[model samples]
Target: MRSLVQILAAVKELRWYYWGIIICSLLTAATSLLTPFIIKEATDEVVASLQGRGGGISVVLWLAVALLIADLSNTIISNVGGYLGDVMAARLRTRLSQRYFHKLLTLPQRYYDTALTGTVISRLNRSITETTQFMQSASNNFFPMMLTLVASLAITAWYSPWISVMLLVVFPTYMWLTTLTSKRWQKLEAKKNSHVDIAGGRFAEVIGQIRVVKSFVQEKRELASFSDHYDATIGLTRSQSRYWHSMDAARRGAMNLIFFGIHALIFVRTVQGAFTVGVMVLLIQLVNLAKQPAMMMSYLVDTAQRAIAGSRDYFEVMAEEQERDELADPVVGGRRELAPDEPMIEFRDATFGYEDGVDVVHDVSFAIRQGERVAFVGESGGGKTTLVSLLLGLYQLRSGQVRVAGHSIDQTPAELLRGSVGVVFQDASLFSGSIRENISYAHPGASDAEIEQAAREANAHDFIMGFEQGYDTLIGERGLKLSGGQKQRIAVARAMLKDAPILVLDEATSALDSKSERLVQQGLDRLMKGRTSVIIAHRLSTIASVDRIVTLKDGQVDEIGTPEELARSGGIYAELLALQSGSKQDRKKLKNFDITA
Candidate 1:
């Protein structure tokens, strides 16, 4: 009920439309009610005329015209109301979609870590679609049905109070039955939705990683898993449908029996001359009118239950806490100046984990001076990427703080903090778009000359020009259309175009062949110049030129010094350097520390 109320409150802007729809519905109901009364008048007049005591055929014709006009009015108003309902529903969908999209953007990154792309999309689509459809249906049907039922009962009561009493009795009984069915139906729906969401999530994963699946030849396995989920839903549906329809049949049977008694009573009263034949016709029509709502009660209950379930799902995401933005002073033009003495980036005793109580980055501390280049080197799972992610403000620290450009990340606005840094991840996370669009993603307003210049600096200009569309060439999803080196170079170009004061390179060139690595490394070298750069690399040769090296082991910083100093000191960095130099003895010694080459 609260979820339904929230849905209504969300569309307050469309209240006038709702009011108009209600007015039309009321008017429609009023026009429809006039038909039976007009028929009753015409019938009595015809009976009197046949007995030579009334005005004759002319009165019947006039009343027939009145009935036509009433029905026409009812039809026109009902259609107009339906049109307004449709418009309201479409506009409501737009507003709710925008709101949900905005909430997704503002949600913390952690929310997405375990969230599946397809499941999230499915939830958004299904929930909003269900809610919008229900509101539209309610606007078109609910009020008209209620008004017709009430007006019919009131008129019936005027003629026969006992008949009206029977009509009233049908409602609560129908409602009680529907309520029971709806609760069980909603539970089954929720369970079905869980299976659907999982299937949808896995479907998207399989499609996106189709290449991986094909390479490993797991097509049959994935298909079986996907089919298994759907098969489970089918079983549940069979049970759910049987239960719903069976209950509906029983409810309808009970309603028919009660109406049978009411009809028989009306017939006996007319035959006994307690009521006129015209009055009998009117009462019968009114009974049928009242029955309409009672018949539709089950359908309305089903729709309402769906809306409630969808609303709960939609609001669950909306209720998640948004990322905090405490912008005391917004950074002007997306960059902040750093004092000469202050570090360009600093992590003070930083500790963090993807989950609580199991820290991935321990109490690590480091700082990079302005324009100094540093590289983080360690074995896999050593928290190098995690540390860089902290600097990027992607995750909050479990303890301590990360300051970028003299602003504490926790206290700074995300846009301000992130806008000051540029990153080139190991995977070139390019979207499905043209090359120009991807290059200018960070700075959408970048001019063509600026774009070409950045591409040139990243060594991507020659290859990009090789294509027919050059910069305008389309890159498929995740840059699938391009080679690994080409994609990495484009990512580098994107980072260069951002031109932020701080830079992060997370194994940017590690995934490429020797020739491709050289090309990308050259671009990295150009990008790192005159900027404070934090690099994560497993390749030892790349960090030789860096001003300092930070080696992590088991989430703690084991060594922090110049590469030459670490090499001489024989720490983890030294052992890694020796292993890379093909020293078998060093490999055996490093294995004792759980460091792999």
Candidate 2:
């Protein structure tokens, strides 16, 4: 209950609805308190009729009407309070979901590399539902119970001071029992929620990679793993339920003792002629009202514990500091004005890695003149992709500087830096949407004619038109429905639609078949015509037409020259060319040179 109050307090912007809930709750409680008084009045009239003194049927009629009015008001107002509570829950859920998504957008690349996709999704989905359920319980059950208990005690104290005093004593003991039970339940609920998360994460993982399960014929194994997680969750839930019911039994036993004591006190007072039968009836009704709060104690505590567990998870994500952009400060914005002869891209003593104090790309320096096509050739794990990531502002520099058209990458806004450069990766990413949507991703407002033109330039127009739905074709998840060559062409067409001044081809055509490679390469050639291009390639043949081939070894520049010049120089580039061309004589010469060195 305390935790639920804290949650409501933190969301102070919804105070107006909170006030509505409070008002309706108070009205319902007031109406309920009137029932005992009405019952007492009708009882006195019945006694008078039985004794044959001042027996008036009209008085009984008036009391019955009053009881009906009180009940009707209580029912209507309680429903209204329930409705307003749901409204509050909906708003809180929306605000939380929006915050989680917005934080995701602001998080740095390193977090994504380490975080599990399924776990994150499960956390976000569960937190909202659990928190809202708690709110509903608190509003509909806990709040009304407290109000009615308090109101009943005050009226009873005014009428029969002794009975009220006895109930007051029992009240604190019942609350103490509830408090102890809540603490233990909270710990158990936390453990239970973790099992739930594991189950949800596994479910999402299986759905996301169903193809792998089918290929490996591991469906039985996967099912067994999921069953283990589900069993753990159910086991924990059953344990919690058993513990709750035990505590509830104790609470009910204590309430029975209090009820018996109160009834005895009323009977003695009536026998002593200090109280009438009508007053005893009223005292009995008040005792029942007092028991109501204690009876609801288990439910309220369980809900509060669950709510606290969920809110803790939700706020933990919210507490993560959003990744701050180095270039967040305002700057004079325009097409970075540079001298006509200045280099379009430059890296000077640039050193970077995902972690601090360890540089995978160390002390590397190079430059590409405007409109010059350059290719970077390197072995696996030679930091080729890291360099491209730096250019796109996906990472911050550990030391030194990288610039595009004389503008420092660290000082330029990430969106602006990425907007000026276009990229087509080896694995083309396409969402489950229409072909037209994927093509116009960078320029969502692009007209049909403009999209068609871009597709034509990328050699994708004919293939796209061949589909029954043409541009409206719904590609399955990640464009799996399309052939490798077809997916690559659509990716190329998307980049072409951006029409940026600089283009990056990250081994885009490396995985295609010979025929697919030819088609994709044709699209690539058209896309790179007027743009300053940087091609990261493994194949020597694909980069032959580039103005310069820069060979990297152990994170340093080993050679940079025209392909023909590098082939004659007999350095890393020439050796790589020799190995790929499968020249036996050159391999023997290189092996002999390596032993001598």
lDDT of each: 0.88, 0.83
lDDT of 2 by residue, 403-462 (tens): 998878878877778888999999889888999999999999999999999999889999
lDDT tens digits, residue span 339-373, model 1 = 67898888899989885558988789988899999
Off by over 4 Å in 2: 1-12, 53-55, 169-171, 178-184, 325-342, 355-358, 583-597
TM-score of each: 0.94, 0.89
Tell me how many clashing residue pairs each candidate has. 0, 0
Clashes counted in candidate 1 amount to 0
Q: 480 in model 2: Cα distance from truth in Å?
A: 2.1
